[model samples]
Target chain A: MISPSIFVFAPLASAALFTALMVVRSRNVIHAGYWLLPCLLAVAGLFGSLEAHFFVVVQILIYAGAILILILFALMLTRDVMDPKQRQTTKFAPLAVPLCIFVGLGGALMMARAPWPAIQAAAPGPAEQTKALGLGLIGDYALPFEVASLILLAALIGAICLAKAEKEPAAPEPVIDLRGEIELEESVSAGAADGH
Target chain B: MTANLTHYLALSAALFGIGLYGVLARRNAIAVLMGIELMLNAANINFLAFWRFLAPNSVEPQVYVLVVLTVAAAEAAVGLAVVLNVYRSFGTVNLDEIARLKG
Candidate 1:
């Protein structure tokens, strides 16, 4: 008899693959960003099937929620973001063909050759898994947990500083708006000629 | 047929390769970041599969997955922030065009 999980895994995996393709191939970047939603959700579903409950939640919350919003925000900030004529892929994309072939073949070969241990028929229950996870985080892995938090703190500060607009009396705008300056100069010259 | 360890490994490998193609081929910086995220997910899949098939009793893999998730979030945040900064100074997000340091 076919395992019941095939019903879920098959559909979820296919959807994820489809959305990932859309994310890469779509000319419209916003559409690609939107497509990322289903792909991420599908991955979460896969995590759930593996009985990684906490990861499934975090995947939905962080990947599907926060990261996606950040991407959309960045996309919106970009000028001509919705332009359909924008090229999504580089000319060097063809180079990926050979790389992919090599990688695929190598991965398949490795999977076939390696001897994986036999899997147990049952997954640990959610409560037992969560308890063990909590104890490990608080006990043996405490130092790493604290270090990870510090890294996150540093990342937060770095991101804020990088994205923040710099203020200085020497320059009103650090980034010289060249297009605006050119337009202003043209208008001023045109006015001078008209005055004469 | 059962959804065995080999099956998940195969799927993860496929996803990883696709993500690699995306990172190498895409011109948009954000799209490149998305590709990186995909690769990370594939790695996470591999971790979970190994945990389930090899050592279901240990919570080490789950903890590792959590750490990876946290790192992925921070990376995305910082990456997008850098992208925004680049956009501000360069006025474009096209990686090919943002070659100020090109020799």
Candidate 2:
């Protein structure tokens, strides 16, 4: 029997793959950045199809919403947004293409050959799943959770420091011709005393 | 066809491949970062698929996914900042142009 989720999953998977291809192939960086939005949304949809309800929300909210925006901001801040004249890929792109294809095919083949011991148990109800997740985070995973927070804080400070405009060193104090000024003043005084 | 673990894994592999190509081939550093984000998403998909299929009752996979997401956010933030800084100093974000360390 075909699962109903296959219908949802198929379209989302296609969208994700297609958009990801567009992301890589687009000459315009901003267009590539925009392509990532749908790719991320499609991944979020894939999360929903997997019944990772909370993750669906998080994926959409964080990956699609926050990270994509950050990327777009970076794109805008950078000068060359649409440089069609410049080659988008490197000289080794031909080699990279074959290597990537080999990697994907090898991974798929390995996964197909592996005999996964998939369990038959169904996921808990959404409410229970969320509660368990919350408990797990605060209970057994407390240390990691705290560590993640610390990492975020550090990243925040680091990003600000890195992106901040470098202050131009104070202009070197103008070299004062103090000797010339002093000589002129002494001559004027000498002339005045001679006149006296 | 039924959507199974293998299917999701295959999709993730394909996505990872595309991301790898992006990272390896793109001349722009931001494009490379986008590729990294794609690869991370592929890993996240793998985590959720495994959680749903191999161990639905356990919260470990989900927790791990959350942690990965947190790290990805941090990475993107720091990475973009680095890219901006690179652009400011070098006046270009082209990976080839910023090859001062190519010794």
Candidate 3:
């Protein structure tokens, strides 16, 4: 009989692998970005199977939701994403097939030789896992958590500044136009009053 | 024929290998970033698998995964921002074409 885990994990894993391949292989940049969505969601599903409930939620919210959107925006801003002439793979791409086989099989063989412990599967109650992860974040990992938030804040500001810099020079043009319009309106009002 | 720790390990290894291939073979900056994201996911899978099979009761690995996710998000944001900057300076996002410093 096929195990339930197989039924769930197989599809998710295959979907992830397929989408990841599509993400790198698609000629259109926008299509590549779109392919990232399913890849991320499948990884999130894998996290759920591992009983990392908090991570599953976070993976979906942050990776699939936020990061993918950010990437899409970048693609739209940076490239003519619909252009079919864009090159998808480099000259070195053909090497990837053999390298992937060698590396993957070699790593798997090495791992198969390791003496992994026969510990119990993580069957932690989902609620308990979430609560424990929360407490640990606040209680034990608070310093790292704070540091991570600070880094994220810095990254956020840095990205904004980087993306905003180009628009800064052109910004004065709009302001100057607005001021001229205001002055023109005031002159029109004065003329109307005199006429009245 | 049940799925065990070794199976998860193999899967993670395969994913990591594929990610490495993507990283090395892709010319587009955004595609390279996608490759990096896949690599991070592979690492996260390893973390969770090890946590489940080797240290089933510990919450430490989960904490590490959380940190990884934060760093990954930050990396993505900064990476895409840089990609945008590059695109503005150069009319192309291809890494090979952006070699202005090649003295």
* Best candidate (score: DockQ): 2
Which TM-score values does chain B get in all models? 0.95, 0.95, 0.94
Better of 2 and 3 by TM-score: 2
Q: Which candidate order results from sorting by DockQ in descending order?
A: 2, 3, 1
DockQ of every model listed?
0.51, 0.65, 0.64
Residue range A1-196, candidate 2, lDDT tens digits: 1232678889999999999999999999899999999999999999888888999899999999999999999999994543867789988899999999999888988888888755456777788889999999899989888999999999999999998989767899899999999999999999999999
Cα deviation at B61, candidate 2, in Å, is 0.4
- Give the poorly placed runs of model 3, Cα more than 4 Å off: A1-4, A170-196
Global Cα lDDT for candidate 2 = 0.90
The CAPRI-style docking tier of model 2 reads: medium
* Model 3, global lDDT: 0.81
Better of 2 and 3 by lDDT: 2
lDDT, each prediction: 0.82, 0.90, 0.81
i-RMS, each model, one decimal: 1.8, 1.5, 2.2
lDDT for each residue of candidate 1 in A1-196, tens digit (9 for 90 to 100): 1122767778887888788878878888888889989999999998887877777888899999998898888888884643658677878888996896578557856886787756764667788888898999999888778878987998999999998986544745578889999999999999999999
TM-score of chain B of 2: 0.95
How many clashing residue pairs are found in candidate 1? 0
